[model samples]
Target chain A: MSGYIEAGYISVFSVLTLYGGSLIIRVRKTEKKLPDLTEEKKD
Target chain B: MSEVNFAAIPQVFSKRAETATKIIGVLALLSLIATVWLGLFVTPPDQFMGNLVRLLYVHPPIAWVMFVAYGVAFLSTLLYLWPRTRDLRFDRLAGASSEVGVIFTGLTLLSGSIWGRPTWGTWWTWDPLLTTTALLFVMYLGYLALRRLPGDPETRAKRSAIGGLVAFIDVPIVYFSVLWWKSLHQAPTVLDPVTGKTYIHGSMAYTLLLGFVAFTLLYVYFVAKRYRLERLKYLYDRVLLDEAIQERKREAADFKAYGADKKSLVPTAFAENGPALGDARFFGTEEESVVGGGEAGR
Candidate 1:
């Protein structure tokens, strides 16, 4: 394939990565609350 | 729901949540890096398809994730709403699944449009496959809107459960819409019509697999995180409600005690003074004994 096609492929994957990474970061921030629920359940 | 029985939210998620999140993170990294190298440096351009074939990397995975999200919603709804096996946990699961479904469906349409514009020469088409998939997305959105309607949890659960189940029928129709109608959308391209081999080979196949795994992990993480948040909100609401009810009960008890004390004091005053005979005359009674008459009857 030509360099342009190769670049296009990278762009596609880059978009996927960006979208997926953003979601992961959001989840990490919220995960801190998860343990509070477990402790409450035990009590 | 009472305080004791209401589910608790966790400060840290369970193993599934942790694992799924990690996998999603790693896969996202790998997909980004690898696709950049592979698409930009490895894969060659097609003489006819040009750069358009690169879209295959994104479109297929987006469609798969969207379908998988709907599957999660359908399965959870069945487990949650079935009378004999009805489990409220599934309610959270269904909500989480639907949320992911909505996200991925939007992605599917976006990627599909990107692929269509260059190849089909239009951003939108009336093709049967595209039309049905669009319809499927809209129905689940309605399911979500209905879920947010005002009422108690139980009522919301029932309505959304029915909506989830009814919406499941659209999945199959969407899958087969191309077969059922003549359309401009390309027929299934994965199959080799002559050799029966998949069109994808080598690194392309591996990267596609990586994308699939990454999306699946991400979906799981989001759903679990959302479920935990929902459980916490539920517990918080129950605690507040319980406190309110207890406060009301205490107030009622105090009022009863105060009323009883007032009643006892009234008789004490009447009994102590014995209300002189003229007090009866105050009421125009003929005899002073009438004061005791009423108290004695009591």
Candidate 2:
């Protein structure tokens, strides 16, 4: 944690993790509606 | 047929992405451990460069991955723009790949400058290879900007594909710049002419190879994640469009049902207009409303 990577890179990794988390949130929201659509089509 | 649904993606794809990610993580850990061991303790200090030469282990792989990333973007863009394969999935993939490529290229440039400061007595250089590599990175940035530009999706894809092809010329130029132009950089030294062998020590060579493989795994994982995100975005937009179209159809149906049961409130020029007007109501309710209002006033 302390030796190889520099302090500046902490910000980079933080931003990447935040970006990835937001992407997951977006995917989940879209996924929730998909099942509802399928159920309606089936009915 | 199997029920292939998009909602189940994270679960369905998790197994493969997880296995791949785990392997990548473990390999990266081992590579880092081995790199530190060999770089710090095992490899003898260089006579001229002192400890600065240790940066070689990081520099070459970052450069290699940067080149590979742009290569992926170039090939994917070509495939995307081909007349037979101009599908939306390919278009999104090209954009995503270029975005990832630009990130890696930025890392390469940053790490190179850091290493250069300690060894070359400067933070930057106008060397041909460095210049061309920088140009390639800027080209990828342009590729990303093309995606964000305002236009219809099809037009954007076509224009971006042309940009991709035009910018990719810098790739080969970056690769061969050392051979074409003399510079402060050393020529490829690992090449052995007579026995056709690179006499890299086993430990150093092994660790560098492992690092390369680990970085490649990381690259693949990143590209897959980006491509998946782009696909989901496309699907989400498509589903919204379909819902809008269905809502419009439902509204049209409701309008027809209302017209059939309700009689006209205003007196008509012809009493027989009831049946004829009904027919027009069903066939051209939207158009009839405009014409009927005009005729009634006349």
Residues B1-298, model 1: lDDT tens digits: 2333233222333555556656765665566566545644566555578766666665676677778888988988988777887877788788878877887777677777766767788878988888888888899999989888887788888889999998889998877676678888765556644456676667666666665665666566667656655665555656566667778999999888878876564566565655544555344554534445433321
- Whole-model Cα lDDT of every candidate shown, in order: 0.68, 0.64
lDDT of 2 by residue, B1-298 (tens): 1333444333223455546755764665566566656655676545566665555565666667777877887777888878887676677777766776777777777767766666677878999977888898998898788788878678888898888888889988887788788876665545544446674566667656665675666566566667766666555565566666767998999888777854553245443343343445434654454333333421
Question: What lDDT score is found at residue B171 in candidate 1?
Answer: 92
lDDT of 2 at B92: 72
DockQ of each: 0.19, 0.16
